[model samples]
Target: MIFLAIRYLIERKRQTLLTFLGVFLGTMAYVAVSGFFLGFHVFIVEQLVNNAAQIHIQARKDYLSAHQLDQAFYENSYRHVFWYFPPSGNLGYLEVQDPQSWYERLARDPRVEAYSPLLTTAALFSLSKISVSAVLIGCNPIQQQKVTSIADYVVDGHFRDLAVGGNRVILGDELMKRLGVGINQTVRVSVGTGNASPFKVVGRYYTGNRFADSQAYAAINDVQRLNGTPNQVNEIGVRLKDYRQAAAIATNWSRIAPERTESWDQQNANILSVFRIQDALRFSMIATVVIVAGFGIYNVLNMTVNQKRQDIAILRSMGYDTFDVVMLFFSQGLILGVLGGACGLFAGYFFCRYLQTIPFMPAAPGNPQGYLHISLDSAIYIQAALVALISSSLASILPARAAGRLTPIDIIRAGG
Candidate 1:
């Protein structure tokens, strides 16, 4: 019976092709759209993970201006004392003075594997060759490896080269490309409103993310010397020996350094919101595609039933049962959907691969990476196939029921 049904569908070449086309379009739309969003989301999350560790600690909300243990120790006792004194106030906006050895205390805690002090300050970068205003980041290479994966992001040069070059700095790949710079090129970088000094470009790094790849990095002391910001950092990246300890660590930070520490998730609330919005948009788009396919299938099957009334009647007169007649039309729709879905799957995969190859940049609201990486996984393929099949089955329902309802005598007389 299935073979006979297949033969019947093959005989109606035009109808078969049209039905297949409908399913094909639906499947392709689903796969391509979903693949793009999935790749885009993964890219953003991965970049975040690379730049900042899973947990970040920042100054908490405090009525007092200082993040110190207490204002009294520094204000009265250490105010006039220059030697072995705390860092200056204005340049120490984000600095944490561990007079009480807070960092050392946290280091000994089993939950914390590593931590890197982060310095963020906007400074006028007046390189000897070319002067450009850029943000400067300072990090310790040894401790940074424990927190951020900066070492892995170097595309062209080594991180240790910055140390070797002394006054040298690392430039982001895209920024370096914009500056038309090469390794060993000397550029002057100054922090705050200070005059710039020549700093050689010791290395270049690329993280496959435009934002991170646009910033420049120098030693922590260099940033402090230029900006007059001493013994202070904007943020601290904390990597747990085990991620499950993150909540416990966060709780500890809150108890110890209340109003001054935040988890990475808390810090990245805005980006996480963006991901949620994108996910919702993707779902709506997929729903629209499935609905459109279902409607097309419904229309096609209804028209086919009207045109095949005589044939249906003839089959009923020749002893075909209602169940058999229903099965025949169901098989037709199923075949069309499955074949179309197969074609769509191939087309979508190639289309996504092509997207990866083309050097095209999306507009301002989109990422500046200029490439979309699509994931062609079994889950995506299965989703595409199911959309086609369900749409096809739904469309054939009315027609199948109509055929089954026809009595042999009434159908034959009506056909005549």
Candidate 2:
């Protein structure tokens, strides 16, 4: 029966080849588009993951509203009012007190790979005549490196320079250029209180984010003193053993601690929203191509069944069962599917490789050459084959059934 199906398809080689080409292009399109989009997404996510801490733990806050927003206010009468305000009379909670306790808890948890206590404060940097207002981050250099890839972006000096004694500071490369200063140069840095204190320039890092690049880093002790709080560290940066669990762990830990916790994903929610839209577009395009390819298979097989009615009837007359007739015609679609799917998978693999070779010229932070990312996920090839074969099989079914129902007697009567 298979031999006969091969012969039938060979007789109409044009139709068979056209239908095969359709399925091949469809399958190849699916793999190529998915690889490009998904690969790009992974690239973006990688940048986000590496440039910043996976989880940021900060002091929590409670807000209060008055009579105009009274619907949100409810209080009992035991020396209590309709609204409760902060006891400290600050805008909100500014600092996380006794961070050593949290550090102890984090140290005990095996999931916590590393954590750094950071004190962030606004400051002014002045060197020669150039002065700029910038945010200053004070952190333990060794621990901060574990949480973020800032150390890797050092273009001119060492990340360890921030650890050096005598109020040394590391600024971004862009900021360094703006300051018109080189290594070991003294710059005046002043926080909210007191007169400007001179700090030595130790290192420079280039992260490609102009704003982040404009910031400076120093030892936690220096920043703490600059912020007028000796032992107050407002932020904690944590790297995890399994970063995939960052968002969930952040939520759980935030509730247990006196701070607000945020994961990289939660911090970049808008970017993920754009990714979701791109995904929808990618799948929709692949689905449309596959459906069109299925139509090509349907047309070819339907035409073949009409042309081979006499053959089908003669086989039925010679005691060939209905199942045999159906299988013979269905085999054509199966053959096209198998061959096209294989070739398409191979073609798509090469296409993705070609894409990777092209230089990506974007000014991404850590990426030097900025090459495009293409995901070589095994599932892409597997799914491409399944989509091609399943659609082709479904297209063949109706025509195969019609061919099977043709009776020899009916054909003879019609001929007569």
Candidate 3:
């Protein structure tokens, strides 16, 4: 049966080759495309995880409800009172009420690897003549380094320079360019209507994020003094022992603490949603190609069954049972699937390697030549091979069954 199957496939070399190519290309496409998209997804996720805090705890603000507002304004005399315009915004200050308690709690928790208290404020940064408005983040330099990869992103000087803390600051690369200043330069920083204070730029960082690159960092005490809110902290950045456990831990923390806690995944839900969309698109495209390949296999096999009716009749008369006939035709599909899938997997791997060698540019400063991120995960190749085998096997089923049902009488009746 196997010998006859091989002979039959060899007789229609052109058709067999075309059908094999369809399956091969489909599998290769699945592997290559999935590798590129999934690799990009991993890259973005790693950047987010490393560049920022895994869990963020911010000061909680309580707002007055409509009923509370009415009670406050009318002393509950008029229960049905309506206002011409609604009152909005929270009533409390933005500073966290207790920083020491949070610090102690975070230190005691085994899940927390490190935490940094931050005092952030919008400030005007001025050089000799140029002035730009950007966010100023104050943190303990050593603690901040433990909580995030900020130290690693420092392109010039050192992030530890802020540890000296006598009005020292680190500017993002974009901010440095905008202000036309370099390391060790003096910049005037002012919050609101306060008097501008001179801060020496000690280092520069480039995060590849435009918004983040437009910000500046200073010591927590310095930021508090500059903002006129001494010993106050507005945000706490938490680093977890295991970053993937952040969302669950953050949810539990929010339930117990008055501070609003959020994980990095929650904060960047929009970007993650886009990754999901990419996944859906990747599978959809691969499915379409596989289906086309399936159809090609079906077409070729159906034609082969029709053209080889006399052979089927001769074999049936020679005591080859219906099951044997089915196996004969089915084996051809199995061979094609095995051969095509193997070739495709190898081709896909080579293609991915080629892609990684291509010259590309990264958005991050200081890195001039970069290459594409292509993840050659073993799962991708396994899935592609499965798709090829399943598609070809399914496509062969109908024709195999049709060939098995043919009898000697039926062939003689057809005058062949």
What does each candidate score in C-alpha RMSD?
8.3, 3.5, 2.3
- How does candidate 2 score on lDDT? 0.84
lDDT of 1 by residue, 172-282 (tens): 887787677788877777664657677788788876668777888887767767777777776677887775456556767777653356666566778878878877976
Error of 2 at 257 (Å): 2.4
Error of 1 at 244 (Å): 11
- lDDT tens per residue, model 2, 1-416: 88997898889889888888888888888888899989989888988888889999887766643443333344443244444652232345788866898899889989999999999889989987788888999999988998888899887678877776569898887788888889888999988598888998878888777888899999998887767788998899988988899999999997887788899899999998989898898779668656877788789889988887788787998999989999998888888888888898999899999988778756554556777788999988888888888888888899889888888887777771
Q: Could you estimate the TM-score for every candidate?
A: 0.71, 0.91, 0.92
Which residue segments of model 3 deviate by more than 4 Å? 62-68, 75-79, 365-367, 414-416
Query: Candidate 2 versus the native: TM-score?
Result: 0.91
Model 1 pairs whose backbones collide:
58-260, 59-260, 60-259, 60-260, 95-232, 127-187, 127-188, 128-188
Model 3 C-alpha lDDT versus the unseen true structure:
0.89
Model 1 weakest 10-residue run by lDDT: 61-70
Name the candidate that leads on lDDT.
3
| CA error at residue 57 for candidate 2, angstroms | 0.9
- The residue pairs found clashing in candidate 2 are none
Cα error of candidate 1 at position 35, Å: 1.8
The order of the candidates by TM-score, greatest first, is: 3, 2, 1
Among all candidates shown, the one with the greatest TM-score:
3
Off by over 4 Å in 1: 61-93, 97-114, 121-135, 152-157, 162-168, 171-201, 204-216, 221-234, 239-256, 259-277, 307-320, 362-371, 412-416
